[model samples]
Structure formats: C-alpha cells, structure tokens
Target chain A: MSLLSNSAVEKNMDLAPAPLKKEKVKMKKGLQLFLIALPFLILVFVFSYLPLYGWSYAFFNFRPGIPLSQSEFVGFQWFKSIISNPTQTAEVMRVMKNTLAISALGVITSVLPVTFAIFLTEIKASWYKRIVQVLTTLPNFISWVLVYSVAFAIFSTNNGLLNHVLTDLGIIDTGVNYLASDNHTWLSMCMWNVWKTLGWSAIMYLAAITNIDPELYEAAKVDGAGRFRRIWHITVPGLMSTYFVLLLLQIANFINNGMEQYYVFQNAINKDHIEVLDLYVYNIGMLGTNFSFATAISMLKSIVSVFLLFFANKMSKILRGESII
Target chain B: MAESILIKKKTKKEKENSRSTKGEIVFNFFNMAFFALITFICIFPFYYLFVNTISNNDLSSRGMVIFLPKGIHFTNYLQVLRLEGLGRAAIISLSRTLIGTILTVFGCALLGFIFTQKQMWGRKFWYRFVVITMYFNAGIIPWFIIMMNLKLTNNFLAYILPAVIQPFFVILVKTYIESIPAAIQESAELDGAGTMTVFFKIIMPLSKPILATITVFAAVNQWNSFIDTLFLMTDSKLYTLQFVLYRYMNQLSSLANIIRGSQGGSSISASIANMQTPTSVRMTVSMIIITPIILVYPIFQRFFVKGIIMGAVKG
Candidate 1:
C-alpha cells in the first residue's frame, strides 16, 4: 500500500503543469507585455532620444533650415569664443553667482518656515492650524506674473505702500526706491521665492511627520520629555530621511534659479541682481538669436549639474546608508 | 486604553501643577503668541491683495489703502474684463487647460497600466527610459524646434501635445498600481477576462484614489503653464490667461509712457495723478486670473492632499 501511494504521488507530480508548459506561459506573457509597451517606447524614442543628437550643435555654428551636412561643424569653436569674450564671460559668471545666491537663500528660508509649520501642527488649536494651512497654500496658486505686479505696486519708489507707511511713521525722511536698488532686488526675489514655495514645501514635511509612530512620542512623554525635547529627538530624527532626500533633490537643481520671475523682474535698474543662467539663455538664444552659443552655455550648465547630482547621491548613500537614486 | 486614562488623569494633575509654575505659564504664553504672530504675517499678504483689489483706484494710487477698502469699486474688474484682449484669452486658457488635463490624465493612466505589469518584457529597460526622460530633458530650444518642425506652432496642440504624457506622472501612477495586490489580478485573469477588460474594469476602479490625485496635479500644471504659450503661440488669439496678464502689464507700462507724454508740461506728474491705471487695477487683474482656480481648489482639495502625500511618502 505504501509503495502504491508513493508511485501515485510521483505520477501526480509529473502530470502537474510540465516545465515546457510553464516556459510557454512565461514566453507568452513576455511577448504580451512587449506589445503593450511598444507604443510608449516609440513615442519616447522619437521625442526624447532623437533630440539628444542636437546636443552636438553646441560645438558648431548652428543655423535654422540648414541640414547637418550643410551646417558648419566647428568643433569647440563657439565654446572657445564664449570663454574668450570678456563681456560674455563676465555676464555668465555674474548670472551664475546670482543664481547660487538666490537659490541658497530660497533653500534656507524655505527649510525654516516649513520646519516651523510642522511644529505648529502639533499644537492643540485646530482652527489656528487650519487657517495657517489655507493662507500658506493660497500664494502658491497665484501666478508669478501677478506676484511681480503686486510687488511693483507695493514697492514702487514714489507711491508704494511700504514707502508710504515708512514715511508716515517717520521711520524714513524719503521714500526709498525699493525695486530700483540692486541690493534689495535679490533680497526681494528671495522673499518672493519663500512666499511662493514655503507652504507647498511644508506639506511634504507635515505628511512625513504624521507618519511617525505614535508610540515613540508616547515613550518620550513617559520619559518626562517636554514638547521641544520630543520634537528634537523623535520628530526631527523621524523626518531626517525625507529631509535628506528633499535636500539632495534641491541641491541637484541649484543652477536652475527660476527663469520666469527673473525674466519678468528684469529691468534696466535691477538687471545686475536679477540676471540668472535661465534668463541668460533666453537672452542669448531666443532674443539675441545666437543659438550655438546659448546651446554651449546650456550644455555646460547641464554637465555640471549632472555631476553634482551624482556626487550628492553618492554622499547621501554614505551618510544615510540609503540610496535615493 | 490604559494609557489614555492615565494621560487624561495626568493632564488634570499637570494643569493643577502648572498653576504654581510661573516659568511654564510664561513659556506657554510666548509660544502661543509667537505662533499667532507667524500665522498673521503669513496671512497678511493675501489680505492686503484682496483689500487693494476692491479699494478705490485713486485711494490705491495715493497709497492710502491699508487694511480695508474705503470704498468697494467693481469698476476695476469691469475694466479688466473690457480690456481689448482679456475675454478671448480667458476662454482660450480655460479650454486649453481642460483639454490638456484630460489628455494628460488618460495618457499617463494608459502608460502606467502598461508599466505595472510584471509579466512585461524589458520592463526594467522601459522603466529606466521613462525615469531618464524625467531626470534629463533636452531643455527648451530643442523642444521648441521639434514643435515647429511638427507644425504645432500657433496651434493649440503645441500647448497640449508636448505635455500630454509626462513621464513623472506615469511613474507615480505606476507605483500606485504596483501597490495593488497581485492576487486580485490573478483571479480576474482566471475568469478569462482579456487584458483590456481587466485593466478597464478592475485596475482603474481600484486606482481611483491615485487617478484623482494626478488629475488635480495635471490640471494645476496646465493652468499655470505660460512659457509654452509664449514660445509656441505667436498668434494673439492663442494666448493663455497668464500670457494675457503679462501683455496687460506690459501695456500698462506703455500706457504709462503715453499718458505721461500727452500730459506734457503739467505740474502734476502724469504717472502719479492719472489714478485710472493704479496698483489696484493690477491687483484686480490678479484676482480675476486666480478666481477660477481658487473656486475650483476646494472641490479637489481633499484629492490633492491625499495624492501629494501618497506620492511623497512612496517616493
């Protein structure tokens, strides 16, 4: 009876979906998936992969309506010319400095406000939290153009609100032309950046904080830890991973000091402080019609940013023992 | 459960205990005051904008408008609407945003469905392809060139086509889809349902939460997009709301020039004394531009909150 039972079990196992049937199923599934994916692959290749070929134009004298064969392929010529021209080089460097300064300030101001917002959410007042949430997010939906116009109205030299208030309060003898001064432009831009982004950035941190295990907070309280201590120990540490990831992402975009705000804000007076790489590209490529030089400059920015992103990723992995990439 | 009762009793005890601690009382007072102050500053700008929008144009020009409007003048709003190109531009912007949102949400959903299937061949390669595009784009020049070559310039398609299938949204949707249990899919497959039916009938219904999220995101992005219109839409009729606002501001500056010139030799400065095209007009214009979005936001605010949280937490 035992021998018969063993033989029957062996036979059942052999009859159960043979290896060849399994292989066929796997192959069919693979083919079905490929068929579904083929359309997106083609779309991406045409739109995304094809444009990569034009990156070579940075080294050439690129012209509209000229075939690749007809266009002059002067290797590294435009790059060398841009570096050699003192005016062009100075403009690039100045914009780079401004971009860094504004972006750094944006990052600093944004982090503090968002952190403060997350802390405020812990307070017992639901109405206060609700109102703060609404106000912070309201500015984000407003267009940058409108924000600039508002700034213009409020900061105009002769009849601005700030000036009127200051003069009325006897804080100043004359109304200062806040927008006209180069020193104030960068600061104003930083404030605008913070205004636009603070609430939105805080949302992510707040979400992350909510996900923290309640047990940790309870344990901290049981150990006689106050609100600040609990926040410093439990909340901040719980948020460290998210903070690092977001920080790395922000650092990766360090060169992209906003284009629209700077473009709209640019005037004869505040041009020095407001000009950034994006505005520089728009001026040279689109406005000036020097496509080749602009491409070269953009290529340089891209290369540097890619390197920085990779380096930051590596450093993050080392520090957190986790890879965001 | 025990902890809750203990915490309640402890809170009562702590309230009695804190009656003796002046330092604690002072600290709590300052904490509450500080938060209240921060909240006020955060909210004051929007209040200022709203008051400026409704206040008298002359009063706004004189910088006398402060916390509240002296008189409500809807005339500035009427003026903005009557501006030469405002109405047409608003319609164009609305239609484009609507169409773009629909197309983007659909395309992203389809792409996400394809990506989430584990049985797909070269899935890794395809996923990486999408992610690479998300990270690196050829910037604006090449994109503009492609649109021109495609004969998309001056067409509404120029605004909608390039943005219709963003890879990041696809990846987000795909991740959400991946979180769905595979067992459910297996049962549907065993019931002899085709891939399309399974996707449409099963996956989509289950993915409504994420679908709601991406829809709001796509809508907001399309509403805010102005650069594409500026670059691609050379025709005045094709201008979006943002582009229209931009032109209005430019026109204001030019009008300021003309008014100043026409009032030549006047003791009263033309730019200052005109009072017709004051800061209030700009504020009114802004309010008009954002009115639709603000009204629509609350409707989708819940979905937006959930979606944003999901994407951030998962990523």
Candidate 2:
C-alpha cells in the first residue's frame, strides 16, 4: 500500500507541471526575452523595413519638405513612363547595358583572385607573403575619394605623372585626358576594381585552402606528384566550392555595382559610358531632382535583386545541397 | 618487388620535391618579381602623393617630384592645418567614428546575444526578418527620403543612429556567441543571473575577439563613409573630413578659397607660398584623411582577418 502511494505521488509530480504551471513559466521567460529584443526589432524596423515603405514614393510625385500623404498619388505612372517613353527607355537601356557590361566583366575576371591565392600560397617565405598580403589589402581600406585622389594625382591631364613621363620619354607629345576620356571606360573601371579587391578577395580562398586536408597533399606526394600537379589536383579542387559560392553571391549582387566607385570615377566625358544603374539612379534623383522616377527605377532594382538572390540560393541548394542564406 | 618499386617511386618524388625543376625555378623567379612589382604598385601611389606633398610646389606641379621629394618642406601640411573649418570637420569625424563604432558594436553584440536565446519570442521569424534585409537594399533615393522623413538629414545622429544595428555585424556576433558553450550560461542562470547579466558579465567577457572584429569593421566604415554626408548634409558644420576632402578634390573652386585664404591672409614667407600649390594642398588633405586609418590598421588587421574567415565559414 505504501509502494502504491509512492508511485501515485511520483506520477503526480511528473504530470502536474506538464500543462498549466510549466506553460506559465515558459510564457514568463518568453515575455522577458521579448522585452529584451523589442528595441532591436524596432531599430531594424526603422532602418530596413521602414525604407521599404518609402518604395511607395515610386507611385507618388514626392516633393521635398512635403508630407507624403499630401502629395498626389500617381498609380504606376513613373513605372509606366519607364516602359512607355522612347527617350527614357533609351537612356535606361544604355544604363542597363553599361551595368550588365561592367558586372559581366567582373564575373569574367572573378577567376583572378583564385589564381592569386594559389600563387600566393606557393611562395616559400611566409614573411614576404604576409607583407604582400598586407600591402595589397591596403587599397581596400581607403575610401574611393582617396583612390580618386591618387588617380587624379597620377593621371590628371595637366600635372599628371603619366603624361609627364610619357612626354619626357617621347612616348607621346602631350598629355591625354585619361581620367576624362571615354575610351575603355568599362574595362578601366573593372581593372580598378580588380586592383582594389584582388588581395582582399584572396583572403577567403586562402582560408579555404587552409581547410583542405593535408593528407591529400601527402598522398599526392607519395604518388610522385610535383608541386604544380599537387596544386592542380588537390588545392584547386578544394577551393572550387568556395569559389563557386562567391561567384553565386556575385551573381546575386550582379546589378548592385555600388554607386560610389562609379560616382567618384565618372566625369563629363565618360558620363555616357560610365553611368551604371545605381549611378544613374543617383544622378536622376539627387542631381536632376526627379525623385519619383529614381524611386521607381530602384524599386524595380530591389525586386530584381531579391529575385536573383532567391534564384542563386535555389541554384546553390541544387548544385551543392547547401544554401547561403 | 612491388614494395621495392614503391620505395623507388617515393625516393624519386622526394628528390623532385627537394630540387624544383628548372621550369619551376624560372616560373618562381618571374612570380616573385611579378608579385614584388604588384606590391610596389600598391604602395607607390601613396608614396608618390607623399613625396609630392612635401616637395617644392613648383617642382611637384611641374611633375618633377616623381620618385622622391625634391624640396622637403612642412609648409603644405602647415597650410592645410590652418584651412578654414578643418579642425571642426576633424572633430566631427572623430566623434562620429568613436560614437558610431561604440553604438554599433554594442547594438550588434546585444542583439546578437538576445537572438541566441531559445526563449526569445519568434526567434526564427525575427532572425529571418533581419537577415533577409542583407540581400536587398532600398535604393539610395528611398533611403535618402526615409532619412529625411526621420529628420536625420544634416543631423549628427544620422551618422550614429542608422549604423547602430548593422545586420551583417549582428549575424557575425550571433554566430560567435552561438559557438560558445551554452552550459556556462545555464549555470549562471541557475544562480539567478538575468539575460542582461549573462550577456554583459559572461558572454561579453568571453567574446572579445569577435567584439574587436566588429569594432574594426564599424570604425573603418564610419571613418570612410562620405556618401551620407554628400546626400544629407548641406551644412558645412556637419561636413566630415572625408566629405570635405572629396569637395576639395572635385571642386577646385571650393579648394581655391582655402588656398588663397591661407596664402593671402598670413605674413607667410615666399618659400611657403611656393610650397602651397593646389596639387600639394590636395595631396596634403588626402594624407590628412588617410593617416588615421593607416595608424590604426596594423593593430586591427588581425581581427579583420579573423572576421573575414568567420564570415566565410558562415556564408
């Protein structure tokens, strides 16, 4: 009878806290946690989600210093203007062409950092490697304004060192306005981007290389493979996943060639060629006072970018069975 | 016989490894020279700017100060230091960097810690809500309009507040904190420690490496950002050092006033006037803007490396 009573008490102890009291405690903890997180949620709402509401401005003739509600609502008029008007369409087409061209160039050259990483690892001296890495990564830290300053100091038409040296060497008779010239604008921009990002981008591949199993190299050596063979067989394949992931990300970000680089690099002469979608949006919105239209173009851009990101994630999952986000 | 053949093959491989082939030696020579040249290219521009700024103005403007300083003088730097509104802009930049970095690091750390709590309401939903923002950006116009609506335009808080809770940094901090053992927090909680107490007292003290990483990224971004000022601030009092330098770089008219003001007002020497050319002044100002970054970079660089690796793993 005592054993039976003890078993009954044990069952009561187990089952009693499983429903109401446990739920109350769980809810109390959740409430405390929610309170802790509420402020951050509010911040994210303001900065990120809030701007999304501003996408509504694309449909309105938004005037500065005027309340949005007081403004006249134009239903898809700005978006329709982009499609219906000839000159506007032509300008946008040009901007789109430039954007695709620049992004395509970057995609083609994305192999460079992988090559840089492989070669960088081949160097015997670690100190020399570290110094090269540090110095090459330096440009990534400085602002594009400073980069432009360096570009201007080196390539300015009048007092540029390029012209000065070229003329002195009889390579050219006078200074050429390289900065202002429209020739190879996209290529030059891509080259500048490569210069800025090569070392910085290589860091990821380097990290991947360290993650490669040392046993692979040992087995390759045991099999009488040479250094280049080892790199080709072991290291390159090991880094493939990392490279593909980065490439997928770049594809997702294809249109977001940020405005800053192109903005600082652009000049009156190269405006036709150098103006990308982001820069064009900035030019129209801020420089030309066409806020509604810029907002419209950007709304489309954001939609496309989100779509591309999901597409990329889909591809990542299909190919690698893993997702980036 | 098979074992002997394997031994022979191993020795041959060992020999090949000990002595690189002739082709590889040639390739290595070129590779080293090529990378060395690249290193030179990376550093030469700054060095050129430096030599030009310090050299005689006539020579630098004439493109004579190529490799080294021809006439060494601190007059250009002195003139730049005395430029109108320079000190005020420097102060604004410094304050923003300090305040922006601190707020962002703290916000990211705290939010990151909060998200890791299993009891947090709507944990998965909220995490996705924040992380999804990283993939798409509201275009500059919308962003600008929002800031305007928020009355952040031309306000100092515009710099500090928008950046306080960077989503990417939040993700980094969250990932780092997740890697830490959860048992420690459980123990502390058993002792009646609150969430904030666990975060501040236990989690934070253990997460210094990641905190440092976030600090470097935040500080550099704040110091280098000029687009916000370019779009939002019309007030010269709110101009940052980088923005001012940008104006001086792009608009010669804006720079002319400062150069003329410096040369015309003071009882300066003839040589000092010769040293304050437009190119010299521009280069000097660029130097001024970049010096702080270069100063702090070496110390914070390892943290960034760790940060990048962490990001790579998470990605």
TM-score of each: 0.86, 0.93
* Accuracy of chain B in candidate 1 (TM-score): 0.80
Residues B1-315, model 2: lDDT tens digits: 999999999999778666777767888888888889988998899989888888888888888898878868877777787788887899999999999999899988998998898887898898888887777778788888889889998899999988988888989999999998776776666557888899999999999999999999999999999889988999999999988888887888767878788777576564743656667778998998888888888787788899999888887
| Regions more than 4 Å wrong, model 1 | A1-39, A63-69, A170-175, B1-16, B19-25, B253-280
By summed lDDT, the worst window of 10 consecutive residues in model 2 chain B runs over B267-276
Chain A only TM-scores, each candidate in turn: 0.83, 0.91
Highest DockQ scorer: 2
The lowest-lDDT stretch of 10 consecutive residues in candidate 1 chain A is A1-10
For every model shown, the clashing-pair count is 0, 0
Query: Which tens-of-lDDT digit does each residue in B84-154 have in candidate 1?
Result: 56678888878878998998888788778878887788788888887777666666666566666678889
Per-prediction fnat: 0.34, 0.67
- Candidate 1 lDDT, A254-278, residue by residue in tens: 8877588887778778888888887
The alpha-carbon lDDT assigned to residue A218 of candidate 1 equals 96
